[model samples]
Target: MASIHILLLFLSCTSFVYRCDGACAEPESDTQAVVGRGFKLGCLSCKRRSEVKATATVEWYFKAKGEVDFVQIYTYTEMGPTIENEHFLDRLDWNGSKRSNDIQDASIYILNVTLNDTGTYRCFFNRILNYDNYEYTTVVSKVVYLTVVEKATRGTASIVSEVMMYVTIIGLQVWLLIEMIYCYRKISAAGEEALREAANAEYLAIASESKDNCAGAQVGE
Candidate 1:
């Protein structure tokens, strides 16, 4: 819950930062789960950005693979979350902020997840604010790409394959860190060389001027 609030603070700043880097501000995350198990879909809204605030609402929708339209499954607002979808029935759990009315974490844990759940889930956070008689809205949304599988094989071969994949990922991360350090050092060295060259050129120009003045004075004398 503490982490959720921290994340909200970070995301709220991006809302007003302009659209140039909006893509990075809100990145779609993916989650994998096995069938007949429970999975949580994470979502958070302004819930309330400022103390002098307005109303906040959250909605979750689902779109199966190859589908164009999304269906609403859950919603939360001042009235609290109401599982509106008949399909989810009694399997939906509000495992989010304790305050149901104004929820910070709209994350929902779905019980007995099935293969049909494989697809994209969208979480919408709508905030209506009225400051100084001017009403405005700040909306924050997130996409969760859920991949549900019947079963994940855990045989000897599978174990080896998983281990190798993990190793590859770790190796790539290490390589990237090393590359960043090398690049930083190289750039610093180049900057130092440029400064040295500029200083040496300035000194030479001053020396030339001094010699020319002395020669002229001697001639005059």
Candidate 2:
């Protein structure tokens, strides 16, 4: 009876240890969003086993049209350039610089976002190494989508005022584009004119010297 009890106690302790080794599994965040007019994308969560003494690498993936093969939007490792997708080359940035094994709450900032920024994003945490040659674990958060809408100002107004505001904003944008093109053309034209004037001056000097030489030859003859 004493031997049987000892064996049971050993089994119980082994099970407890196995459970506590990786008991704090990372939790995923729900779908979050921000106002389309504001300069914000959303916050994401990433975490790993608390007891594991390993660095975590975070990566963000994005997909349009709900496709399975998502493209990599951003990647953060130990040391290197933060890899970004071609589409978001200049718009996306890490919101903060906080890192840990249990949980990482990182936000992303997007500037001057348009309708094309709307899509599904997934945050991932990959363990850097495994204990005693154990396989590394990867945890993924739920997909989040961004919805952008036109901003409404001055309370709820009549349809005419709303339409006028949109039209005015679009018109201003078009005018600015036209002005830029005009300025570029003017600068190019001035540069060409300067080159033409310099060439004409060189030719005039050569012609004047040739005329003086011809007059001198006639006098000698």
Candidate 3:
């Protein structure tokens, strides 16, 4: 029982770490945004060393279809989100990590989007990793080309990818459950067999002792 509990605890810890580890993965964001709807611009920049303490500031820039150059629109830091452009005032909100200084996901949400919002957006992460001896700085950036549309449509590839992801997740979970059940059954069978062997040995020892007593009593009489 103690061994089973320990195994369960270890499995729980492993799963927690697997789910919580904000490992860097640069997935492409959806390019389509429906007008008059809220859209989230995805951005992720995970630290290579999670154990090392770090602080990050995120900056967002935008360049319209006929723009000369990119203009800074939004910025977020420990102080909170700041909208630098009046065009995006009260329209942009930080949709990423809120509680920690080590910001991993730097996504932002745009409310009541418009055709004017169509452009190329860039997310920049300026991070400082604090080590015992010194601090190291690193910069990472991700760009997304977005288009405003009258109606939202899902691409065939996106739908297929989502379906495949769900299938894979369910398959892995089912396999893990089956493995756990098999392991429990095997352990229980071994334990029962051990108990049965011990019971048989005790019975045999008691019977042999009674037979010796009977023989001694008959000899005395």
Q: Which candidate would rank higher by lDDT, 2 or 3? A: 3
| Candidate with best lDDT | 3
lDDT of 3 by residue, 1-221 (tens): 55588799999999999997855776777889999999999998878887899999999999998897999999999999999999999999899988998998999999999999999999999999999999999999999999999998888998999999999999989987987898899999999999999999999999999999999999999
Mind giving the per-residue lDDT tens digits that candidate 2 earns over 43-79?
Answer: 4443444455566566788776456678888876656
Candidate 3 residue pairs in backbone clash: none
Q: For residues 8-95, could you state the per-residue lDDT of candidate 1 as single tens digits?
A: 9888887656554522222234377789989878775534344655666788898998899999999877766699888888988887
lDDT of 3 at 199: 97
- TM-score (C-alpha) between model 3 and the true structure: 0.64
For residue 28, model 2's alpha carbon misses the true position, in angstroms, by: 7.5
Per-model CA lDDT versus the true structure: 0.78, 0.65, 0.93
Per-candidate TM equals: 0.52, 0.44, 0.64
Superposition-based RMSD of candidate 1 using all C-alpha atoms, in angstroms: 12.6
Off by over 4 Å in 1: 1-30, 46-52, 152-221
Clashing residue pairs found in predicted model 2: none
